[model samples]
Target: MAATPNIYGILAEFETPADAMHAAEKVRDTGFRKWDVFTPYPVHGMDKAMGLKNSKVGWFSFIGGVTGYTSGMVMIWWMNAVDYPIPIGGKPMFSPFGAFPPCYELTILLGAFGALFGMLFMNRLPRLHHPLLKHRRFALATHDRYFIVIETTDPKYSENETRKLLESVGSKRIELVEE
Candidate 1:
């Protein structure tokens, strides 16, 4: 339950993002599904190069923002106009303008929350471990290395075949990332 996935395939490290990108695309071209790449910084055009889909988190953020706006507006309106019927400074019972600040803040809060949760859900995060973490050199990934993980779930994944595949794709240094 703690370990996220039984990553039993192979891992290949790259000295640069370009190499990682190249290897990832070639690996994908060969029909490998259970694979992911790690990078220290966002690499320009990496998404397209890796054949990744646009994130759906935007939709979640949109919905969350709408919800937050609605919640803030309704709460303020009800409290001032209908719930308590308080009349302050001769202003209108429901001050739509007054609600703007809180509504905006709420929208941002909700949007951030939605994005965070959406990412976690999309990525299946919060697990205790990953296969890449087991690799001794994988620690360098966060510092200066780019890495690709090919998991065992892929039909094309086999120790020998995966090794050959990585080697064929011009992997700089191949290592078995364990978990």
Candidate 2:
């Protein structure tokens, strides 16, 4: 008996951005969660067609910025007022105006870090390998072609049905990608 190959997904290639966008819409309508689209350039309205929501990176950045600002203020207060009282020129020991510069700088720094880390986490990036990377046709995605990959792990995936769906969407080429 022959061992069955591990199927990764179904890959559909499109001739143009419009075709790929339309295919994405159909896939989205079919309610497949484990799917993604690739294109040579950014496709306007692709997010909507894919039913994607706003990124969570902004929330991460906001939280980081708030934490940074608060920590900066607290650190300055601790050092100036609590740890050692330096009464210079009758100036207040702890002042918001004085802390604003360092607080603002920390806020920017932490916010940027949050955005970078958040993006990497959300994308599951730094991946060492992917089945699609080995596919010869997939490389064209960076050059001229657009491709849509519907993972077999998706709840709605049915080999026959998914292939038919791709055909209906006018895919130029369809292949079963294996792991």
- Index of the highest-lDDT prediction: 2
Query: How many backbone clashes are present in model 1?
Result: 0
The digit string of per-residue lDDT tens for model 1 on 23-105 reads 88898788877788889989998888788888999988999899999999999998889889978899899887988999999
Against the true structure, candidate 1 has what lDDT?
Answer: 0.84
C-alpha TM-score for every candidate? 0.85, 0.96
Please give the clash total of every predicted structure, in order. Answer: 0, 0
Error of 1 at 91 (Å): 3.2
* TM-score, candidate number 1: 0.85
Candidate 2: deviation at residue 145, Å?
A: 0.3
lDDT of 1 at 135: 70
